[model samples]
Target: MPPDSDGVPNKTRRDFLKKSSFLTAAAFVPVTVVNAAVNQWDEKLASVFEKTSLHLEVNGLALNLSVEPRTTLLDLLREQLNLTGTKKGCDRGQCGACTVHADGMRINSCLSLAVTNEGKKITTIEGLSKGQELHPMQEAFIKHDGFQCGYCTPGQIMSAVALIKEGHAGSEMEIREYMSGNICRCGAYPNIVNAIQEVKTGGLS
Candidate 1:
């Protein structure tokens, strides 16, 4: 027996070997792997709930904001920026109540994600006029009585402005086709067409 064993009492070779084998197995158990797995789990959880940064211009005002991944542009305008002129009629892409101009082109804000429109210039219905003076299209709509409930008027005016700019107002039928997406529950189609025609002719001040 070794000198170390002689000094010890009642510690048999079988018992020592078993304890040593347990210690040896524990030494190779990879504790760092367990710590790494925990860290990876934390990172994934943070990524799932983290808000993303967004940079965009609204009504010529540059803004920096943090938004959720699922936030829609319509909600960002109406709820976040308080531009409630852009109504939330359908929330889906069907109704044109959430129309807005992105980079001078009209789009259904309800269908666009806020994150996707980062760095874009967005124009809401509230951005149409200067101070207290109305936009030409707004004046035309008022003169022609294009809306009744006014719930869909903002979107309608936005679309009409874009339509005239796009040259789709060449004919009444073409204008109607292009403006079909915007629904006025008040049944003001004739007046809406007249308003658009008047604006197309450059008759408004």
Candidate 2:
């Protein structure tokens, strides 16, 4: 910038930068407007074809649901079927608090697509009881105090039940390794393992 007669700069770099920023923002205004408009159009188009139907057995009850194809199994269970036992920890499948049994196998319900669960038997924590009688795993957890906050208890019990049914609950190390996916943030792992071991080895004492 040219200096004035007083030997002072007429305009500093900060002033130039402010002007340049305004010009740059003005130039990008049209692009921003167009992008927002296109996004709105894309969202509308995507929502248009999202409606879909799925049939699955949840908690021993047959359910035929009409939902968006993008709906996850967790949402289907919690939002649609009112089964809130499955907690949503990390929706990206990193956490296993949303674990459930599908077709007798444990899977992260958050990552499972509702549309793909058709004709599959889905078992949640709510299904692990007969009337008022608790399942063996449930009883074991209660007896052993397997959980502290109890947020992860449902998924843990679900996974443990499936493992017991599959005869995978042999050794303590084996149970820990198998149950690694279901994390207990409260560090109640020892007691949780003890509960599963008791239910598996017929030694609840």
Candidate 3:
């Protein structure tokens, strides 16, 4: 900036910075308008991801919901249905933390799509017990100290119950083979096996 008639610079550094900032901001869309555009775009994206109708019984409670095709049964349980007892670990089928029962069959909820189990009966950890009483398998797990960190306990119990019902708990090796899907990081395998044996032998009521 050159000196003006009065010997002062035409614009001080502070004045130049203020004007430059204003010009820079003015070159873009106004914040309010940009925010509105972003919101509209989000709505369009959501509409593009069409939601399918889901009707099923979870934990004995009948529910009808709208979910996206990509929505997993684990997400449907924990997120929308508020069934947090089924843990979401690994997100992939590798971890059995998201185990649940669909129409009497144990399934890795994370690997199963919500829309694929329409009109099915789902059972979660929360569905095991009656009021003020724990299920036999749940009780057995606790009695046998089947869990340490306990993150894998729910899946363990669910799988154990199904294992007994499926007649796969005939021996120690059978139990391990059927429960190979569930990985317990805390190394509670021995205790878990004991609990399943007890339940299979009709040891716990």
Which consecutive 10 residues in model 1 have the weakest lDDT in total? 41-50
What is the RMSD of candidate 2? 16.3
- Cα RMSD of all models vs. native, in order, equals 17.6, 16.3, 16.7
lDDT of 3 by residue, 36-118 (tens): 45565434443344566789998888999888878899998999889999999999999899999999999999999999998
Ranking by TM-score: 3, 1, 2
Error of 1 at 27 (Å): 25
lDDT of each: 0.85, 0.82, 0.86
lDDT of 2 by residue, 1-205 (tens): 2236997754445445544544554577777546645565434544444456678998888887787877899999999889999999989877689999999899999999898887899999998788998888899999999999999999999988888887878888989888898989999999999999888777642
Error of 2 at 179 (Å): 0.8
Tell me which of candidates 1 and 2 scores higher on TM-score.
Answer: 1
Off by over 4 Å in 2: 1-49, 203-205
Scanning candidate 3 in windows of ten residues, the lowest lDDT window is: 41-50
